[model samples]
Target: MSLILSRLKCPWCETPVTKAELKEKNLLQVYLKRQAFPCPHCNQSITLPERAEKMISSGLFVSVFLAPVFAYGGWLSINPALLFSLGVALVLTGVYFQKLQKVTASHE
Candidate 1:
């Protein structure tokens, strides 16, 4: 019989699992050796199944968690170059995710 990977869903949010979000709150290990994923919609760290946990942690996610208030606090002190650097970082992050998607698609 062929192996079937299980899809993990969030118990609280009832959404499919995402690798990145799962890693955020240390939930991936709970389902190790099983096929499961974390739901992207809810803050709940649900589990799901997959060949591997490969998810892109985008700048948007990081910014939401780490930027804004920090940026605002230094908005007056920091130069425009700081924002430009952040933009560049975001662009690179997007490109990296695109590349990851292409690679994963080819595998499937």
Candidate 2:
């Protein structure tokens, strides 16, 4: 499987942000809102793309769909491990999409 690397960067300073930091801060909200937040590196306001809102919605749908299947399969085989793995996969995919979201400069 090919890994999708995040291209999320600060618009003002062009500093790259890691997936961990994105998830930790729930930066997806910023992206969805096309809102500005101060960058840790430069203290300048950074804006993310509004397009990510759609991606986040889609990812949630996929996760919701897979969740039941994985849970049912695990229960049938007496192996609950698959359910946990599926949950992790869903979370990772969501994060990857968040990272993949294109950053657009908001016209203020």
Candidate achieving the largest TM-score = 2
Candidate 2 Cα misplacement greater than 4 A, ranges:
1-8, 16-33, 66-106
Model 2 C-alpha lDDT per residue in residues 13-94, reported as the tens digit of each score = 6778654665576764563455665555565666654344455455555457655665666545633455445555655655
Error of 1 at 105 (Å): 18
What are the TM-scores, per candidate, against the unseen true structure? 0.25, 0.36
lDDT of 1 by residue, 1-108 (tens): 111134434566555555566577675565454433334465433323232223223344444544555566765565544554565577464444331111122332
What clash count goes with each model? 12, 0
Query: Model-by-model lDDT, in order?
Result: 0.43, 0.53
> How far in Å is the alpha carbon of 12 misplaced in model 2?
3.8
TM-score of 2: 0.36
